[model samples]
Target: MKGAPRMPQDDADAPRFARRVGILVTGIVAVSFWIVTLLGALAVVTRFVRTIVVPRAKRTEPVRVRDVDLARGEIEFDADGDSRTPGRYSFWFDDDEGHARVGDITGGGAVTVTRRIIGVDFGDLRGVSRGRLGSWFHLAPGEFGHPYSDVTIETERGPAPAWLIPAAEPTDRWVVMVHGWGGRRPECLRAVETFHRAGYTCLIVSYRNDGEAPDSADGRYGLGDTEWRDVESALLFAGEHGAGGVVLAGWSMGGAISLQTVLRSGHAASVTGIVLDSPAVDWHDILAFQGTLNRLPEPITRTVVRTLGNGWGRTISGLATPIDFARLDVLGQADRLRVPIHILHSRDDGFVPHNGSARLAALRPDIVSYDEWGVARHARLWNYDSDRWDRSVSGWLTGLEG
Candidate 1:
């Protein structure tokens, strides 16, 4: 008779208890200072790697340029939409800044044709204050339908997606293009086009939480963790389709995924070269840089970082907050790679900074060829001055194979 259980006194009390406990823990963690920061860093890194395997949208053959004589034939179109070109053609531009049909020569002769330009705007982030990162990620899929016609590859997380443009001549060399955060497969067409012109089959890939692959298994982005699989799958698909050699190229965070894939794909002997455009080397450092650029309070930024580490991170990542910068610790893993690396970055990349390209170039000097330009925005050096930037990077890459 004395073994009776006590009934709930008040449901309201339970809420109060949880709230009070939460406040106390927060205060404790805040007082502990560096403990939370360290934990946050770990959490961010863990979720980032987890994102390496998100699903992607399938892309079929999309119309893109294949060749340029470099002398008599000029790709006459402006890339940035400045409308400075005197008498070039008009083309559509798809970039981070916004979507707009641009006048020829606005992009400084980056494009030779005015039919359909595959680029974006954001060079002048002067007073822009809107949109989430997911908005950018979904932009491409929404704009252009999936553009590939090849066998679909599956990721541990889900099926890796891409826009495949098979070479007309079938050079047996495949170039896989990976986009940065807030970007989809076609976003890299401007860069991948150069590869295609050089006689290589091209594959512009889209990762989960990006483009049409927004709802893969993880249902959250892990930075390059799950995204890296998309690149890896592209390489394998290229190999199976008769690619004698493989080229992995990435922009921004996409560069980190490319690095990780190159290091991990020891099984793919065909992957002979790597190309990084303004890639970050360390996630920790990148967050600080972005934080400074965005003017976020140090305390709040660090706190959010710690919370990321405390949880499974899926919930945090699926949140798709802007605080989720790139994690590029892949340099440590680069030690396992046996291919040549080609890096290009501008000293004036106000956003990504130039240290990343420098460090990556140094990671494998024996097999790496590094180049740095001046005053060019992220991935826009070519658009600013096509004659100069394009010639430099394109010539270097071509010379390597010759």
Candidate 2:
């Protein structure tokens, strides 16, 4: 049989068959790999976009108060479109800058419910009354007994609006306050009360991408990478405006900005101290902590973190340049810090983990005075217990000022 002349069709068919089989196997493997890689890449990109590029709506629209039952200490209201009242909340009228009322929603129904109100009202409601606990409660610099004047801080971008609340007794030492991510300048009003009372002038500032301030190129958060420059500009403004020494009081991401400014700014020597509340010291640590809470795989988060700082990832994430995650790592660079830093962190912080701050404190106990609180989430240590939070922060300021 081997000696017989082989037919042309038979010889051609054998080679052709082998070729087709090999191609099929190769195609299948390549396609499978491509699909898996695409999916993983998508996951990484989505997380990066959500954290860095996407703008989270700052504060929810206020719920309307339908009726107030003074006799029963309950107020009825219609919650329309994401106005669900969960846990304890504060209520204030349209004209009332004083958020002097706290209450809880006791009755839950379809659309309208009743809440138990504590404290007195702001006289009588006239116009549209809006109720919010976290945000609107903080007055815009001048309300609630603290006198404030509207001022502008000149930045590289443009003039950024701010609130300048001078202390009763003028001191060259000023408290330059920075708010958290998506937080307005008024968010510093809580800290303003404590610092103002302690005879320190407060300059609550607004940075880029704050909606009111000049928008960034992509309108994305720099995660303290670029935002720190705005903070440095504020320091320059303070120096020009008769500030001898400055105490930086920052919350959440603001704390990161403060740290970066101190490390990067030439005027760092003028910074007497820093106060960080639930600060995002290390972004990688915080992202991983949140990833654990969301039950995302470690590999995906690792990839996301890697890509966040990678140039290729920057292109994919719509960023002009790669994020400097190393710069955001205060814990890693704790030894470089020269000024005294006071950190107030909560063990139960959901957004930014307390471990990062704790590690920073442990790394430089001589420079850092860390105060840990329980049962409070990120940036709400003061809201949980106002008196205690104020006293502790005031005491730290006193030590630094003295």
lDDT per residue (tens digit) for residues 270-318 in model 2: 7999999999898888888877877877877787777767888766576
Best by TM-score: 2
For residues 63-99, what per-residue lDDT tens digits would candidate 1 score against the true structure? 2323322233233322332223232121222233343
lDDT, candidate 1, at 367? 79
Measured on C-alpha atoms, candidate 2 has an lDDT of: 0.77
How far off is residue 132 in model 2, in Å?
7.7
Q: How many backbone clashes does candidate 1 have?
A: 34
lDDT of each: 0.58, 0.77
